[model samples]
Target: MNEIISGEKILVTGGAGFIGSNLCEVLLDSNNTVVCLDNFATGKQENIAPFLKHPKFSFIQGDIRNLEDCLLATKNVDYVLHQAALGSVPRSIKNPITTNEVNISGFLNMLVASRDHHIKRFVYAASSSTYGDSQALPKVEENIGKPLSPYAVTKLVNELYADVFFKTYGLETIGLRYFNVFGKRQDPNGAYAAVIPKFVKQFMQLESPIINGDGTFSRDFTYIDNVVQANLKSLVASSTSVNNVYNIAFGDRNTLNDLVVYLKEYLAIYKPSIEKVPVIYGSERVGDIPHSHASIQKAKKYLNYQPEFSLQKGLQEAVDWYWKNL
Candidate 1:
């Protein structure tokens, strides 16, 4: 087993985004020397603003699509948490070429850089969307289907590249197939904003929330803290866990309709009028999967994974953050 030690140099690509920023904060708190590389495309400096002055923190404003930048960021780094990419199915459907350049090309650049830098381990964010078109109730890593969208294709490609890198270059890599991750710091103003934060913001402003696909589409909705924990664990897990992919999600599912009800109930404390607001249903979204659940046994066995937050508890904490910030 490889133990993650204090004072190790770590480079976190996309470290200014929601999940990346949380991971940066955790690593910095644990006494790791952290370098954050981001282009500010979807990531905001405000997310990592507090860490700017920390002694062990460094920020490099650069894009991973640029090979020089990737190489420079990997210098003397012990580990890489590659999180930079364009996310969202609708966004990918609208402009797939751009998504490919960032997710696939950019990822390849990072892999090459990490291999050359001799980094001990590489952990990148893979997506549950990779299980596209598979009708299985709980998705497992070994059983996957044809990708349904450009975004799915990009993520599936990530797993493929990671596998090849391990076999051909002897680089240790782990891919985390994240389900619907949501929590504080998730952007609520974007056109392709995720459902949880988007709905929380709308309901806070007394606006009716929209439900795609008749509100029956369900998701595992893993919280951000669990994701941060998974990343840390992946970096420090035993050699037996290396060169593999794991499903990083809470083993539960909730329909969109159920999510709306939960959000309304939580928001009612701040806005009692929200209890009366109705949700509007629309046609199913293209590139949207009907249901998503993950079989997390592999992660549990290999990484000693133990998720501590449930949907309700996470949602309440997220709602409180929005109430104060938004």
Candidate 2:
């Protein structure tokens, strides 16, 4: 197994966002110098507020769409956790041009900068949506289907670009196909808010949480900490594991109904009435997969990514957080 990388300068591109900020916090805790670059379009100021005072933490207000900003952020950076991209399938469907600009062109810019700066490794956030329209129960890294959405297309392009960079330019790149990641600091007010945080917020305010489907659609709902661990492991993974992608997930499946039941069970501790809050079902979303469960065997074999939090454990943690913080 590879040891966790620490005590070096690292760049987290979306360090003000939920997953990136958590990575920033963990990197800082591990005695690393963290340079955060975020444009604050979707990333929040409060997400990184605590680290503003830290001596090793630095923030740069910049966009990945600009090559100059990418160049600036990668300077003197040992590793790059490239998380800055316009996320959401709906958002991409609504505005594919901008999504392409940020996720594809911007990703290329980051790759160019990383290569130019001679960075050791480039690890980025890939998506399960790349497994588009496939009937595969457990998604594998090598066996990907066609992209179902514009967002999925962008992610697929990112992987292709990464592979080219590694094979052609010799820039070590690792892609993490993140499942439905949810935890503290994930935005709950936006139209593109992730389901877990959005549901938690709605239930907290006594509003009915809406499920997009009949609650039977299942997902490999991964926790933020598991993702954080995957990122850390990617940083220190051996050279053989450098230029491949891994499924960063808990390797378990849960339905929307199961999620709601767990949420009610956990949130009931703070507000007993939340348990009585009815769930409203609506039409299933477009470009939404019926089921998404990852085979984390590849990740375990290569990155040694052992996810510490199960769905219930992580949901309880997230609920406790929202109850106190939301």
What is the C-alpha RMSD, rounded to one decimal, of candidate 1?
1.5
Q: What are the per-model C-alpha RMSD values against the true structure?
A: 1.5, 1.0
Candidate 2 local lDDT, 1-326, one digit each (tens): 23667799999999999899999999998899999999999999999999999999999999999999999999999999999889999999999999999999999999999999999999999999999988887898888888889999999999999999999999999999999999988988889999999999999999999999899999999999999999999988889998888888899999999999999989889889999999999999989999999999999988989999999999999998888897
Question: How much lDDT does each candidate structure score?
Answer: 0.93, 0.94
Residue 63's C-alpha lDDT in candidate 2? Answer: 94
lDDT of 1 by residue, 1-326 (tens): 12335678899999999999998998998899999999999999899999999999999999999999999999999999999999999999999999999999999999999999999999999999999999898999899888999999999999999999999999999999999999989999989999999999999888988898789889999999888888999988988999999999998899999899899999999989999988888888898999999899999999877787788889998999999988
RMSD of 2: 1.0
Candidate 2's TM-score reads 0.99
TM-score of 1: 0.98
Worst 10 contiguous positions by lDDT, candidate 1: 1-10
Stretches of model 1 off by over 4 angstroms after superposition? 1-5
Query: Per-candidate TM vs. native?
Result: 0.98, 0.99
